[model samples]
Target: MTSQKLNTFLENNLQELKDNGLYNEIDTIQGPNGSEITINGKKLINMSSNNYLGFANDDRLKVKANEATDTYGVGAGAVRTINGTQSIHDELEAKIAEFKHTEAAVAFQSGFNCNMGAISAVMNKNDAILSDELNHASIIDGCRLSGAKVIRVKHQDMDDLRAKAKEAVESGQYEKIMYITDGVFSMDGDVAKLPEIVEIAEEFDLITYVDDAHGSGVMGKGAGTVKHFGLQDKIDFQMGTLSKAVGVVGGYVAGTQNLIDWLKVRARPFLFSTSLTPGAAAACIEAIDIMSSSTEEHERLWENGRYLKAGLKDLGFNIGDSETPITPCIIGEEKLTQRFSKRLTEEGVYAKSIVFPTVPRGTGRVRNMPSAAHTKDQLDIVLETYKKIGKELDVIS
Candidate 1:
């Protein structure tokens, strides 16, 4: 018994999207998501995953997951404030704090929830947040949920941030001011100017929050961007995800013991949502251990990134300005971008097209995420396929 109005709205929007070539068709990946993936019985090189270190399918993490599952079953059975605060969860938080060089930490179910809970918990209608223009969707939504006056600072523009922070502070309208940004811009693969940001925050006495979802385990020898700039004690909030580089399924905020204590009591998700499973917590702990002990995988990931970027650039593809391992093969037109991605898939590569409004219109791109598990041979095949498809689609010379 669907509402007629809801049905009409859905039908019209769906039809409009299809007509405008804006509809996204999802593909199912069979088996483990690693260097290669299978879709519709076809194996293709995988380059669209966020598994930065290839830890998603690592056997060490798998073994830890299995052991924890056997010992604690599957679920935590209740919210963390209830009876779900297991010892493993405490260990995970402590590990995250130690790894991030923070005084304490609090865990959440997902990165998005971490942002939503943390932002709203500290900020209210009388507060203000200066956010980067290119911050992640989760960050945007979290700012909105906070009921704070959100000032969109230009992406990585330290001058703009300084100006906005000064204005917010002088306005005397807010009880507290905060500046939040992604430690690494995911789409552009650009690192935030943390030293400058810290300076601005210090000048304005603004609270700092860094969502290092893409930077954790990829930057600062696997600590994060804050550590990358030696600002471990400078930032107020060091937020990150276990689902990305850590290759598990949770999020956490590492900061002063006071902040963690407040979040534990105030963040709605931690109060009402079920805690992460024992398996996930243990797997995350193992991933941290592996990262702490070695830089082999980290070095491999960067080497692979450089190799692929060089190959694409030599072939005349419009690879965007990326300072990190994320490579985006930009194709201006939306329909053309979609077609190019489809051709790549057909040619044994599984890189997907990213279009508006994920990115700006006409800046459509096929983003590639090269992982540590990717061999040179597999990357060569991917490059060859990209060459074949890029020429056929007239996306490159």
Candidate 2:
């Protein structure tokens, strides 16, 4: 029983969102979220998942998840600080450290929670964070939660970053400063200027943090964006998600042993929340092993990305300047973008429209995430659908 006023407030806001074409309709997939998904009994080519490596439905990961479940049940039973730190959890952390080329690592229940925990754990009111303007929502929320003075530098503009870092540091108002950016911008599929970021970080003695959620298993031969730039050792915090390219459920921060130790003790989520289930932990470890052992899936992902991008570009869609497979067909108006996405879905493609609040105004786009699991034929179908919808909607000739 909530208050009538609270209910009224929620109803009014929801109605406003619907009227403004900003309310998102959540779709449920009938089976595993793979290259193709079934929604309302209609199968569509899935170009919206973060299953970059196709590990979500991989047989090897399934076997590992089942095996771990048999050995350790479904739940962790308690928070990590209490009794949830099972051997598998520890093993996962060790493998994460190995995979990321860090001295140590710690895991959290989710990517957002990990960022929230990690950012707030080390940064505080006395510190200032020089963040990229295009960093993830999780990163933005984490900074807000950290109570730190946040200065957003223009996205991947190293010169702006340096200026902000210098200003923040010389101001003498903050005890420490951190420069944080995403390893890959998920929305545009553009990579962070890590090399330049690192140079600026060194010049200003700024602690470098990279949230490589979209970079892992897709860049650096499956190591990640920091590793792609060969700056793993220099980054103070290298955070990533097991749910994205790894195709499981969790997140981790790979860093120095001292930093990890501090996070384990201080990160509120790790301290207060139950750990990832044994199945998720084991599946994630196997994912890392797979990523480390082979490059087939990673290569296929990039190949699919290139193919989709090339086809979409050849079809005359305004695909943004993306270095990776996350293709965004920039449809300028919100309602038009939503209509475009709906037409796409009706035509058997499952790409979704991203509008203002998620992206800036007048930059609405239908984002496509090409994964390793998507076949040539499947992609061909997608391309055909896009062309059909593009012409019908007058997005292209």
Candidate 3:
């Protein structure tokens, strides 16, 4: 077939996405991703970023990045195994180990890559994985890549996890079993029941993996979910992102020194991809310093989350059962959800609507990410706008 014919075939398949209001358009941010941001020449109170601690645009991080770039250049120049491992990368990993209260840590290019690399590196086709139904896409992909038997348990249902874990181990058909879950569910902001999970893992001899992507800077006073449950020693894998909370770009796995060493030798990304830039590595170290020194940013973030969630609830929107700083205003239909997001942007709030495929169909939502950088006055304005939009859309009485 001709190239033009193939293009037409692809375009036809995409028509359904457009017709169902699932087609996503890219929006360019004109300024720094901060409490308030410029998009399309309009300033909006940004609520869609994962920068919960608001360190992405922090002056200290910027200064550190500049200094590191001056000292070590812009890139690491080769894959980690082939002379790409800079001193700063080692220092950053050490810093992360200290921050996570682990014996050692390994950094990857992104959180997605970390999951893809670590999970597959640890388990093989002979093993089995008991995963949360609502775990992130990265975890799902990693399990698939591992050549393991992937069994998904119900979200946060310890009973289901226990049952599946027991079945996997008792059958004795698999060489090993790993139980994995998101430390914090990104969409609903609900924390994983780590204590219960750890107990089950112990009973079944399953390796415990917790992806704390959204929990790192927002839970357990910034040490993450393992710390939140005081199960740091019990969890086998403590996966997290420097991009989201730490305000830089990278992902990490924190565990025993042996685990870190194994990953360094076996993880595909670590062996094959270039290391994180010196600037990002240095900035991430600085972020860990900030998170460890005090809880001021974390406190400010929760205060803002509570304030905004309370305001939205008072207006009668269906804010789901989110126990963390991540909040979602559940709007039923995809079109309505997108319209709601558009209205919020028009009224100067930057929260984006999430629809099917990201969540189950018909359970579309507008996810709000409150940051430490947002002042009370800014949150108040956001609340007022939400109230106005909610009333207009009949989302609230």
Clashing residue pairs for model 2: none
Q: Taking the tens digit of each residue's C-alpha lDDT, what string does model 3 give over 1-397?
A: 5799889888987898888988877799997899999998999999999999999999999999999999999999999999999899999999999988999999999999999999999999999999999999999999999999999899898888888888888898999999999999999999999888888888988998999999999999999989988988999999999999898899999999999999999999999999999999999999999999999999999999999899888888899999998999999899899999999999999999999899999999999999999999999999999989998998888
Q: What's the TM-score of every candidate structure?
A: 0.99, 0.99, 0.98
Over 242-274, each residue of candidate 1 has an lDDT whose tens digit, in order, gives 999999898999999999999999999899999
Q: Write the per-residue lDDT of candidate 2 for residues 122-211, one digit (tens) a residue.
A: 999999998899989999999999999999899888778888888888889999899888998988989998888788888889998999
Q: Compared to the true structure, candidate 1 yields what TM-score?
A: 0.99
- Please list the residue runs of candidate 2 whose C-alpha ends up more than 4 Å from where it truly belongs after superposition: none
TM-score of 3: 0.98
Collision pairs in model 3: none
Tell me the whole-model lDDT of each prediction, alpha carbons only. 0.94, 0.93, 0.93
Cα RMSDs, all models:
0.8, 0.9, 1.0
Prediction-by-prediction clash tally: 0, 0, 0
Clashing pairs in 1: none
